[model samples]
Target: MKNLVYIAFLLTFTFGFSQKKTESLKIQNNENAKVHFSDGPALFFTNSDSLILQVHPQAMLIDSLWMNKLIKSPLYDKEQYMLGDDEILVAGLEELPTDLLKARLKYLNSKTPFKIEYNPQLEQVIRTYLQKRKSSLSTIMERARYFFPMFEEHLAKYNIPMELKYLAVIESALNPNARSRVGATGLWQFMYQTGKYYDLEVSSYIDERSDPYRATEAACMYLESLYKMYGDWSMALAAYNSGPGNVSKAIRRSGGSTNYWNIRKYLPNETAAYVPAFYATLYIFEYAKEHNIKSKERAISYYATDTVQVKRQLTFAQINETLNVDIEVLKFLNPQYKLEIIPYIKNKNYILTLPIKDIGNFVSNERLIYAYADLEDTKVEKPLLELIKLDDKITHKVKRGEYLGKIAAKHGVAESNLKKWNNLKSTKLQVGQKLVVYPKNTNPIVTAKVTPIKEDKDETTYYIVKLGDSLWSIAKKFTNVSVQNIKEWNNIWSVNSLKPGIKLKILNLLNDQKK
Candidate 1:
């Protein structure tokens, strides 16, 4: 099978070669750390001897033939970022002469901290990407033109290596909505706790992790943080893929070798491939033209879109209904809003990114769009903490032997509520994960007959009214607090005259019930 050959080719190149029974090469600290062997182990290798290995292009090419006997999933089609997730084919690639490959790699001045080795394994991945995955590579290239400017800006802002921009391609194939099987989401594949640390809010209607611009910025910050922790980009990347704790353990296991290659064997299997994949991707992208790869036509140019702040809560349905803009494109442009609805709070800001041509239509008919229907009136899901205990604030630091269900029971809350409050897609918990608990309470009005929605007696929420927000709509958020209560709180006798940007304080308790 194609997979079998592919595995053989990779293993042969990456982890092959029998150790010589007598006087085999073994690598030691610093003296000959970079010595790479082609036929045997680098046991007892010292700086006094040569560390370079010469590989015949024809030999590798012949081996590549067996790996390309059959074509499997064009990895790009399934999900672009799943590296080594499918068959690798080099059958149709315009072969790069060994001398020319060495020449080109040397000629291309790369400015990354990670070592870009030109080995059979790296070449295998590059050739596979350029040949079998050419279509996907082209697509990624086209989209990169649209996304890279932002990536560069953020990378520069954080003083990170500009070459690190390719990380997004390897993380999510530039797809903002791309999610990993491990529940890491977005271009950077941030887990829920990591995303929360970066301040990417996830609610019923919005998930900022899928926002291209915001997520890129968060990724930059996170990468910079990792770099600070490890002081080496290669190790930082490894830590980024598999946490710093794992990398530290690997270092300890590798006898305290600071060099990534020396400690590479101790890293997780996937993580060992991670750095190589990144390097391979960087090489392919940098010399795409040399490999006869051309980027496909892009949907929009870098400046084709514009972002506008939404003064009020609005949905894709409402926007499409009024402005005639395709909601699908809106979703594509703004993938962060989980429900295609952007929530608006008076003191906070939310934006909708759309094509420049559509911005005019949106701005012109903003009022009609927000006031289009009663869709926003429906109750949206709140954070888990807000749905559980009635307290205003509670922090639960994960302890040993604690699970979500157990934690929920201890707090007298539902397990599902815990996940939502934490924006966790799974129940896996670390020993020290800090969870915020927003206590939920039912505050049914003690009225004669009409029982409205329940509220938390100890809590208060605020809202800002735009052209479309109304007393009736705002009242829906509370159990018994109605339009009368809103009018009384703000001293406003009329509803239609609500001014945009005016803050309204909402108390949770019904007036009579409180009394």
Candidate 2:
């Protein structure tokens, strides 16, 4: 009886320890599964039953399987103690093979989210997102580090939700120069008309839609207005994605379903996906550390900068010379100024962002800098008007069955000149190629004699046929001539079928000798 009791106690203790170990493994696996770090590759673990690792700063649990892999992989070296995978485990970060860690990160970053069970519709959408995400993540991570701080600052100033930062990630992946197929542009993806409504200047010289600071402020104001109308964050976000009109229509269709999910079915396809994508992105970013994704620290300079008001036109090149700074740095600071020319009209202040340290240097040498910039602008005078005039030349749309030579002859210009003006390398002319026929006068003036043709009152009016002309063209030669005229007068409409040297009748004839 004593032996049996002792055996029972031992079994119970073993079972309890086994349960605890399984529970620990589950927790670690969950932590390893999450995606983290906007810039680094995603990290994940395969075998949750092996070892345990923890994230620093937060001390989140990491799965042992991943830890073991990291330690054992080629990424880790056994000797000379590098920060490789082998040393990572030896460094007491985890008790698993370091080889697993390397594999886990690769898997996590590359893995697509689990597909919805028995739902083909949702699976298709998920697949598309995963495919697009593969290429997009790298670009987004690169640009986000530089832009996020400015975005956060602006959002905070407006008392807006910081989560709004994800909107840019969805809109253009933080690419300020992004232009959509439909012409929507910038990091926030504002259309031209909408951008103009928000006071974002759009011109040949500059597109303020690409200006990170200006566009963010505009987006915030627009979002604020939407929030005021909808009274719901989700609805406001939907309205922003698919316009307020569509959201209102959806609401009305759903019998006033204020919930996003309730009205999601009635929303536009992309808008429905937009909200989910936003939520997924927010979740991924929030839980990145758990996934073992390490962010590469980049010390961005110029965070502490002051904007100086300048009221004169200044080029970045000029600024570089005058301020003794790299032109590239100025470009990084002022991306809004396309052509690198600051339009500083008199009394209209252009805010120039400069490093705080350089503010003193600028103030002391303001006059000299201004003078130097003015001189540079004058010396490097661009023939902007001439370029515009050239662009404004008349265009001739090519018609069907017409070649370049025919069109050139019709417009009284050489084929080569037309090609040169239109930047065509070949003689091929498509049906709608807008061939430039007229160019600005760039030739010396020449005098020529003017002779007038003499009109014959009773003479036979005959039309001279030129190359590529046919007799059928004679019937349609005169505005009032009928097809029967060619068959009646010349007794041949078929023969008039567009042959060279085919003459047709006209009302009267004019002789140059008589004039």
Candidate 3:
């Protein structure tokens, strides 16, 4: 009886500790946190609406507002969403009948070994496709009109099911230039090493994975190989998402079961979502009309375009100006042109696909187009060092007691962005580590410019310096405060003299902050 009571007491203690840990996670705090997020900072983007700065999300409606602001921010143009990131950001949909879905999936089933099953998670993803993310899906549908035909042609060569093309839909959403956090690229989302194994080249100006035709062929081959190895297309689909090695690991954990659903519990988080997303996408694509979803009309399609060989190196701007074609349209059609330039080589031919209507003019005016170089960009030479020294970047060295959130707040950037740039998995920090900050395009880059601290009629406040607080860092908290000013006001000469809890007088800070 005494032993039972002791065990019960221990269980109660562990459960209470777990509750406390979970509570600490739900509330925002800076100590040893995985994700260092802060609230109520100045604007991060320059061209964004002021409401973005005012928006806060603990409330229900404000949650969507915060996500909308992020999509508009400059970071949206730079940062590519990986699997986990998409699951969070992609919007949701209302629930549908499970029986209807199973019937539809079973009806659409073909040569591919697809398993039509329903779970709450998969249902949620189906909702995301049919309801919440309707606009995004509509846009993707338009792009599919241009890309899907090409994918079908290539995939047919290998005799892989047409359904497998939807895997690319889940991989990159049909964006040929899409790049993942783990360095996957192209419509197929091939990583650097995998792309190389398939003979895709990567250079400063050329990444073959961004080429629609070549990468699609490579993806088909990879999928075929995966299907051969697994024999079951469902497992192959899972294996394709996570490497075969991961599928093997999942198989081992599931006691030699080859079924995806059976071994799904042992698979990686992203791969688990990946298989369902692919099937859910297939369902939506087939029954979109029933769901009242309509594909948006695309400005261009493959049937209306023609490919031509370029003998000379040319920029998209030159082509756009010479042919009177939209530069954005050129970019969309030819995503492999990384720097907006289609490079030519002595031994190899480079092809450019253009609208069929413009091909005749392009052939006639080839000589004039070659000579129409925009020399304005050539006058100034780009320095090697200048690559890192951008107007939008800020360099900061970590100090004691400084974590991700504090630095992000000071510089007006997101902590998640910081983690992305630095490839950090956690919010843990080390003293004296240098961090590079990239602010939103709409926000001014915060630099180390010291201004004169204004006085509020001889009023003063005392600050108890924290562990990582230097004169420079403390000064940043107040406008127009500087390291030199702190020394002058406190009569301190050595920076090393600062210790935690040491009170320092800051002049006119309280009232000066109002202005």
Candidate 4:
């Protein structure tokens, strides 16, 4: 009897300890994952891992959870779904009956210019959203309440189909500041060159691509142009994801087929999934009531907000204090103002947007607010840097042993931009090929002959982390340096470790560090 009692006590103690440990681990992980930076403006990372299916020049990498779910489903082997070499797979887990889905899709097809007829792939995408991403649909719907109106206004002006607003839903999951891994940014995921071409200005102090109104207008115009090129909305969407060149190639490869489904095998894998994802988002949002997806309550709407012109330079910090507006609300309203400072250059008036109630307060006390902002500016230790406007284009002639990376680095431009500007299909460059470049920096470093420095493998240097420094940006400052290399060298895996003034160890590189 004593032995039994002792064993019971031991088991209870062990179980209690295990339970506490598990709870402790959960709390610790949650804390680590949500480490907030209070020192400066918070960097809002996109809700991308859950939603966006990247469709860029490179092969698409999707969320592993979605991929795994598809792999386990019987729909994975369906011939009707053209699974790409890079695995364009998504299957709904028997959540909704096929007949019901087909009927709904038929309704949707009749309503939109897009060819949204029922297919196994389309059904899989819709079911996947209904099953796995149903919870997120509520939040997405709430955001749509704020953004869709603006999207619709512009779409109507351009005479584009109103349902085309759903494209933004999948492109960004309704996050205005969503940035893809390849540097495609904003709600529509516009590449730097594409954004520039659309006259969406990207300056140090402002990225108009993140501006809801401007970005929406740009998207409508671009979509309108694409529609003109390909007489089909589906084909236009395919061109939007993979460039028209790729779409044209696909059509040619598919024996002059203009239909998207006919050329699905020839198109990029990501483009194949892109149209279906958009359709899935449209279906979920359209039939949210049937799916029992409830929208979360949103306090603010685009209509409720109004803009006031700033007479002088104003910082969000100053405005937050003086107007008693939340800094986050100001950030949300004026996303174009990077670094949260509205510059007051002569003849270049930058507007400050605020809630309708706050607009009256701002306009009434404009002088006092400017006085307060001026006083605050005087108290600052460092004056904000002047915005570098990218206005000039320079031609770079490719020399022997020269590649896109080498040329781009020499001119201080992105390789993607170089490719886009020159319309080069691939990274390969022939000798004497001239590339037009809109350099971010007016003065690019001229390559100079360097003295060779013998270095030990153990020798390392430290980099002082700046306010806006990211691991990716830091890696780009050195020759042949990669983010992975920096991660391993500094033993710093988390972005939380990258606070200002933190010194990161970098290995010595050939040709020293980039100027």
Q: Would you estimate the TM-scores of all the predictions?
A: 0.57, 0.48, 0.57, 0.58
For candidate 3, what is the total of clashing residue pairs?
A: 6
| CA lDDT scores, all candidates in order | 0.62, 0.52, 0.62, 0.65
lDDT of 3 by residue, 436-483 (tens): 777532122222323445656458878897533445336545554544
Clashes of each: 11, 29, 6, 0
Displacement of the residue 10 alpha carbon in candidate 4, Å: 68
| Index of the highest-TM-score prediction | 4
Give the least accurate 10-residue stretch of model 3, judged by summed lDDT: 48-57
| Model 4 agreement with the true structure over 1-515: per-residue lDDT tens digits | 32354456547645755434221100011112222111222111222221111111111112222222322222212122222345444554555788888888899888888888888878777776676565556666766776787788899899999999988877777766666668777788899999999899888778888888888999999999999999999999999998999999999999999999999889888898888777887888888888889865433666656777787888775675444454446666787876667888888757888866467556665654565455444433333334333446777888987766557656555454566677664455778988888664332222222234464656677789754345644664565565546655665533334455888887775546755
Off by over 4 Å in 1: 1-81, 85-94, 373-515
Residue 111, model 1, lDDT? 53
On residues 232-289, what C-alpha lDDT tens digit does candidate 2 reach at each position? 7778889988899999999999999988878989999778877766654553454445
